[model samples]
Target chain A: MAQWALAVDLGGTKIEAALVDAAGAVLPGSRFRLPTGGGSSSAELEAGARAVIGAAYAALPPGESLLGVGIGSAGPIDVHRGLVSPLNLPAWRDFPLRALAEEVVPATPVVLRIDGEAIALAEQWVGAARGSDNLLGMVVSTGIGGGLILGGRALAGPTGNAGHIGHVEVGGMNVPCLCGGTGCVEAVASGPATTAWARAQGWAGSTGEDLAASYAAGDAIARAAVQRSGTAVGQAIASATALLDLELVAIGGGFSRVSPDLFGFIREAIARRSPFPFVAKVRVVPSGLSDEGPLIGAAALIHRADYRSEV
Target chain B: MAQWALAVDLGGTKIEAALVDAAGAVLPGSRFRLPTGGGSSSAELEAGARAVIGAAYAALPPGESLLGVGIGSAGPIDVHRGLVSPLNLPAWRDFPLRALAEEVVPATPVVLRIDGEAIALAEQWVGAARGSDNLLGMVVSTGIGGGLILGGRALAGPTGNAGHIGHVEVGGMNVPCLCGGTGCVEAVASGPATTAWARAQGWAGSTGEDLAASYAAGDAIARAAVQRSGTAVGQAIASATALLDLELVAIGGGFSRVSPDLFGFIREAIARRSPFPFVAKVRVVPSGLSDEGPLIGAAALIHRADYRSEV
Candidate 1:
């Protein structure tokens, strides 16, 4: 019988649960998903969570041991209290997601790891950052999020916001973030932000997909917008590297794929900091995992218990 | 018998060694120091290390066993390889201070930690941030340097430069750092930097002490200079807090004492980021340990073995 962990990944738009075996694979037919959006009612949210979680438990193979349940959510989560108040889901203020998980899977240990940080754990366990324990994993889609694995351990910090890098302000970039900080990496680099920048620069693009098309066709505004976003990201990464001394950073997400040149621009910006080898030595690469990265990482939180809530 | 570890702190201007008991006290009369300048020849530097190490060994109490040695030096030190190449010490590039200590105290393990990061260990163990396991310790004198105590342990990243915040560029700061990074916290906030800016603004102050005196006497330029440095320091701290989720920050070094208002300016800048509570909640205070913090922290690397060289 294969040892396993039930992994739940809760995002702004959806909730997903799956049984992931020790090898970081999602057991076939074990995955379940449900939409739980920003406008979700309290009752609707719980119902959705129950549906996905119930399916995950039902998929458990009989006689096979279940290690624990790991839930990865959007953060500033109160890991100590097992509560989550993901920014995009304002209706769920300090919602007791852990308690809900416990109710669904009684007597099993339920651990909460932030979704962003879980990605780093996944990358470190089996993806791009597999061989390097000190890594930062990033997602640059509708909004930017990141996770850190330092000293071979995934960090959740006191508030499970250990690797909350999106809101960190970037130098010389003055865009206002909804987080109320000006020039945050998310404000300058996320898909919407990049698209908006291109539109403002007189490009005809209305979305990331349109921007990617224009970028491939060599639209000047589109190319400039991508460079601007990637450069800001590189700047933020340089600051983070200065503080954490990370060995590798893996970038993933929809907007990051808008152009391969996005990475080139990032490298150019980092190379400017070559005066500091620690910053320059940081290897920035595209994340090697598929979309299932977060789920696989959530399971790793339990399966790789030695590095657990350092998660 | 009191258990003790030898601690050596190597800086640009001096080398100091002492025996510190497990209780975090430097054994009285066990401390020794010698001048070691940036221009010192390799032979003179080795002689100074020998002198300090020999005195520390001689001061060790009879019949008491030695716990090992910890060396703290200005970074970027290679903790794993036990080599250091501090910027100011031009002649001692990649100096084998760890091996030198081992030769002086044979059969004893010697661990190397960057001096800036050592300060954080000292703060966590016995200073203002003593009870907070997650903290950033800063020195704001001739130069600004910092260390991180994250999740209750000091961090020495791959290169032993984990908490090297001095050279991280600040968002609005445009000052040029000697390290080739623009607007680095050190270039914008260090004592010498502050004094230079004040002088450029026609303030007659030529040193940090003069600026402090001028500010006390109600000089506008001096006040602005102080605010400039403090605000920059606060900005860097906010960025660091965002990345590390620190609980407290203990600050020392000569320039920090220029005015009580310095802390107020720092608080004011940090308050601007109140939109992010994690960044806003970092408590900045004076160092609780006296000037002996670095040495005590070095000894801590061995005495507090659980937290050791996590230093």
Candidate 2:
């Protein structure tokens, strides 16, 4: 019998699969990746899920026993029903993800959750927030997403969308977000949004990587854009800290590498604006897992069985 | 071999003590109360704590074993050091609460937490948030205080103050709060603050209860005052729902009962202002454990063994 579970992390840009052992270690030779795009239809999305699972299954020894499947999707998931309808993934409207996985790997239970919560769980179990009871994990990539682990448990509210930090309004920007909120963190500071904001401010940079390069080169517009994103993020974290009394905020994603100076600026902003000293102490740090975060976090679900999972 | 624990709920106006069991049910004839005031010095506060604890102890059988002690104090407490220097407790700075409790009951272990977190814990253990993975417990009394439980654990951040929701900035409020923040929900909506705001607005009410009575008697000014507080609270909750992805906000304390119309107004305001369907689904409800919330929640600290106890 295989002493491992299957973990799938579905992102807006990629799909990752891993066979995670009972100890949360990703088994060697069980990790693979696939591309994801905005143009995919519902059928395409289902097929993508099947292809990844099938490939992972095939790599395993024939007739090996398997644990349940844990799938972490982008956002707006219904954990109870294993439904997903992420705003960025138009094809996944109310998609029965667990049922589809059940069809692919018959009789193995499928546990569905938002990617943000999965990352938080990962952090709580084995990453930056290890040994901490209260943690907030944020993904500041093409868009901002977050999850909370309070009192040693992942907080999945009704519909499994608690910790949707992107939609919480920050001041001074009325830019509309895909989540239908105005003045949200994503509206002002997601990778595309930050780049767009910089472009509108007459910056010549076209990409986040280019923006980062220019920022390292001390370009004025690029620095301002990065600072702006950091400011919004810092303000949001301050508010979150005040509201939730979080111990640390573990931030990850490609866009978060804009500059170390940006994090300094965020700390300054939070100190100046926040009222509560406890909230002010909430550290905003980088994710420890880096590229391996999703896989490790996916594995965390099976490893931390009492925290989540059915049967 | 007895399972009873001594539970203490310390507030600005009163200190209550009760003997509770493993299930958090208060023992008959074991609950007692005492008055507290602002001028209380460290010695006086210690005396007060001793008095209440003494009363509960005296009420119990002399041979009964007291398992432990749990203290739910008003902020701000240093849970790590077991010290309390609450804003409401003026003469209290760096007071060793657990040490003092040890002086009272040397052999018993002591657990210290903010009253807000205790309330949240109470709800999580036996009240409204019993089965919820993500819960926010709010006390809408003299000031708005809160505690959070995400994924079945208390969100006690660094310093053991995880759910300090009062300082969360509510947009458009120009009011200043004791926490030094302007536009805070507490500044605009807390009991004394709301009453003061109403009085400043030409309403002759002397108290929140009086204001509630006036509103019940159809006084326009009183009704408007209540509505204003409700609106601010609703807006804050809406923001919290967006940020935290919370399922239910269980509100308690005297101010919450200002009107039956309060939660209804809050729900309406949230629905009107929420940018997403999920945010609108967030429930605003009264706490199931009202007067007994703190004591019950203090015992939940033992019952919810998933959370590590400082005691």
Candidate 3:
């Protein structure tokens, strides 16, 4: 019998689920998603989660044995308590996500991990970080998040938030972050953050898309904003690499695509700031997986032994 | 026959070797040391290392079988090439310390690791971090250095320099560090750095010991300097905990003992800076091991299975 893992990804704006095989390919017609947002109530979230999970399970192919279920959710997750208190979902404080998912498929094991970790696992499993034993995978959209793969295994810290790179302070910055920290990388490097910085500098950009277009047209303010964001990210990465001795970083999300030379800017910042040869040697590359990365990484929680946590 | 490991610790001013049992205890009367300073040439270092290794071997108790040899050296070491280019030891650049030690005891595996990693392994094995799976051990003496024990194993990155936390920049500081990095923790928190900062501020202290006395006497400049160092350390620890989700930090070395309230200052800074609960909850404790920590940790590379690397 073919083995399949039911992978669920819960984000601020949506809930998605899909069935993935051992080869990392999603099963035909097994993917589903439902809307979830800031205004979503607990009951609404619960219903949305159930609908997505059930829709994906119903599409499971015949003669296939369900291996397990893996869930990747926006964090501040409590892997110890199998609970999630995502910053974006105030109505679902301490939500028992694992138990709720288990109730949908009784007698099957359910694993929950932070979304950033799931993305890193996906990249390591079948994406750009395929051969690297130590890597950092980052998403730089509306919010910045990251995950670490160290010693060829996912580094799920005590609370399953080991790779919270976005929250680490970048030297010389005093910007306040939504995460209640000052000088956070996300405060300076996220898509919205860059756009706002550009707008504040007299640029007429109101969105990341506008900023990207202006940057392509060689607008000075747009270029400065993009460079500032890239520099912040690079500084943060340098500190992480210095502490963890990472080999590479895989970057994705909308802001990272603002300019093709964004990677070059990040690389230059790292070289200029990183003192050690080992830290400066870390390579920054584009994420290998596409939009399906989160689901695949969630599936990896069951499909790949390296991504599994004892908790 | 009882199993024993020959442990060697090479520092800026001296090289020491000792025999350790599987239980992590150093054998009495089996330890020896030799001086090697900046003026010492590679030939002198080789001769000093040979003498220490020979003395430790000769003192090996009867009926004890040598398992292997473990060596811990100052950064930045190249574990891949078994060479050491210690910043403090200018005379030995890319010195093949591992091969030199191996030649002393033919056919026995000689494992080399950064001194900071050896200290961390020692702490995790039998010191303050016992039973904690993820911890950081740091030395805050003449120059700051650190090591990480993650998932109950030593995290020796590709270059054996994963835990070089001293070089990581502390946000908002622009102090020039000896490691060629700006705003590094060591630049602001190391014993010499703090002393220098205090002196520049009109304090009469010329050394860490003098600063400590002045702090004990309630000198304002001295207190500020100590607090500054502790704050920098705490901020750096917050960043490390945020990135790695560490459980505890064991601090040792001379500067950390400058003031008893240094720990309190560090805790306060972490609480003030760490945006996440997991990072703020990390315990800061005194190192369990004494001066022998480096030697015990060096032995751990051979005595403890978890600290052993494939390379």
- Please, what is the whole-model Cα lDDT of each candidate in the order they appear? 0.85, 0.78, 0.87
Model 3 residue runs over 4 Å out of place are A178-180, A273-275, B178-180, B273-275
lDDT of 1 by residue, A217-288 (tens): 988999899999989898888888888898999999889899999999988878788877888899999999
List, residue by residue over B1-311, the lDDT tens digit for candidate 2: 56787888888877898888877689899998887779777678778888988888777677777777888888878888998877777888778887877778777788888888788888877788778767789999988989876555666666777677777655556676655444668888999988888898899979888998998999888888888888778867876887766778899989999999988878876777444777887788898895898888776655554653332
* Candidate 3 lDDT tens digits, B72-115: 99988999999999888898889999998888877889999999
The DockQ value obtained for model 1 is: 0.53
Better of 2 and 3 by TM-score: 3
- Winning model by lDDT: 3
- Ten-residue region with minimum lDDT total, candidate 1 chain A: A173-182
Shift in Å, residue B225, candidate 2: 4.4
Provide the DockQ value for model 2.
Answer: 0.32
What would the TM-score be for candidate 2 when compared with the true structure?
Answer: 0.83
lDDT of 1 at B178: 65
Q: Please compute DockQ, using alpha carbons, for every candidate against the native two-chain complex.
A: 0.53, 0.32, 0.55
Docking band of candidate 3: medium
- Docking level of model 2: acceptable
Please say which candidate is ahead in DockQ: 1 or 3: 3
